[model samples]
Target: MSFKNLPLLGTAEIIGALNLSPKQTASAANLAHRVAQSAWRRQPPHKRGLSYEEFASTVSDCAWLTMFEFGALLALGRHHEALLLADASRMVHHSARTDPPK
Candidate 1:
């Protein structure tokens, strides 16, 4: 299944999936930071009307979508697709911080 076709989960569902103990998920913090960074990178710079909380929320949603796509690709045994998603995610993150969207 393509990532786009994957169902969207609520915040509660996402949090539930990441319910592992801190020790069991040593990279959780890093993953979260990267996701936030990615979202900021993808946000458009001209869109200045959004408050900080709104901007963060939008970024968080994008990060979650990317993660969902990544997981879906993996589940479909599409390693190449997963890699592409990962690359896109990284690009979104780096670009947002470096270039400022729009």
Candidate 2:
């Protein structure tokens, strides 16, 4: 799925929460996107065994989890953790495609 379809909150709410400048909100979305990708990977180690429907449902749940993490980190001003989550998200997102989500 496109990252744009990761099920984010309304833009106004997100920007309000972060208290960012309009310019900063753009970068904030990128940071929150890291959280979204992390949430996408929050599946069981036995994911290779799941059916397609199971995978889709799991993706939906993980997407929400990523949103949760993004909100917390943003509220706390945890930019560094956002970076780490972004890096981890990239790695996990890549590895899932590679090794089938172990």
Which numbered prediction scores highest in TM-score against the true structure? Answer: 1
> 9-101, model 1: which lDDT tens digit per residue?
543353356453433232333344454556556768787667645665655566665665455445445679779979987897888889955
TM-score of 2: 0.39
Clashing pairs in 2: none
For each predicted model, how many residue pairs clash, with residues at least 3 apart or on different chains?
Answer: 3, 0
Off by over 4 Å in 1: 1-59, 100-102
Worst 10 residues of 2 by lDDT: 1-10
Clash pairs for candidate 1:
38-93, 41-96, 45-101
lDDT (Cα) of model 1: 0.53
At residue 48, candidate 1 shows an lDDT of 62
Q: For model 2, how does the per-residue alpha-carbon lDDT over 1-102 read when each residue is reduced to its tens digit?
A: 123534455555545665656456555555555554454466567655665445545555454445545644655678688668657866876877789534
